[model samples]
Target: MNLPEILADLQLILEEYQSRLDHYSDQVFMLSPEIGCWSMAEVYSHVFGTCLMQQKAMEMCMQGQGMEGSAGLNEMGDKLFALGHFPPGKYEAPEALKSRVQNIHKEDAKALATKLLSRIKSVQSEDILNANEDQRMEHPRLGFLNASQWVHFMLIHTKHHLNQLDRIERKFSMC
Candidate 1:
């Protein structure tokens, strides 16, 4: 796909996510239905830890500084990917990450969502073209996810969880 197409799709995804989350900002954290269920805050945090960072890693690889790979987990995530899922391997996410998410506040979630969109938008057009999906790189945690697929993961996964967040938010009569 052309760089513009990829970037535009990513931008749309971010905008949609932010719009949905904004609607829930006025709701109480305790009442946000996804309460014990990976709240909106947790989902945003996971998008950063799991997908956004991976996109950056792939970008780095295109610059000749390939990411550190982990065949063990890569193999596992890939297997799950083939089955239409991503496995949460041991090294897939550190304990610190889970801890961070569990403690995240609503305000923090808004801030994180802002930061993620900003960073995602900051990726240059040239960089997108440079980081072709055909280019392979080692991933720090779970190895390779062709450059294109890495970005796709970020978009698709974020959209998927955002849908979940919508369901949770719907439980409230915030309107």
Candidate 2:
């Protein structure tokens, strides 16, 4: 997609996430409402952390040091944008992030998410846009991706979690 289209979709997804958050009361947002279920706060925190990591990866690519030159890796990146997400139950968070996931306060989640959204917006700038498309970085599971693919992955990743948030909202009757 072109820059405007990408930016619009990114903005749309971020707005949708914020709107979902708006529907939940503070108490409701904090409730898991089921065993092994994550609270809305934890969900937001996870998304925020993932976006932060993506941002760092983009920065690394700009520095000419993160590219791993994985063969056939662009196809993996294409599949992510095409499929929208990893198949449910088919992927797991790394052990380090597992413990970091927790029930953050509502305000804190909003702040983190807002900051991430802002970074998403910043990617439209010329310098970021012109970053080496040939540069690649290795993902733990999805394999190698270039700078634009990283941003696209952020969009696909947010979209994947939006569905989970919808179900959680319904489970708690917040939707």
Off by over 4 Å in 2: 72-78, 88-91, 125-129
In candidate 1, which residue ranges exceed 4 Å CA deviation?
A: 1-3, 25-27, 30-36, 67-97, 132-143, 173-175
How far residue 145's Cα lies from its native spot in candidate 1, in Å, is 2.0
Compared to the true structure, candidate 2 yields what TM-score?
A: 0.84
Residue 76, candidate 2: alpha-carbon lDDT: 57
Candidate 1 TM-score, true structure as reference: 0.67
- Of the candidates shown, which would achieve the greatest TM-score relative to the real structure? 2
lDDT to native, each model = 0.60, 0.75
Alpha carbon lDDT at 61, candidate 2: 74
lDDT of 1 at 132: 45
Score candidate 1 by lDDT. Answer: 0.60
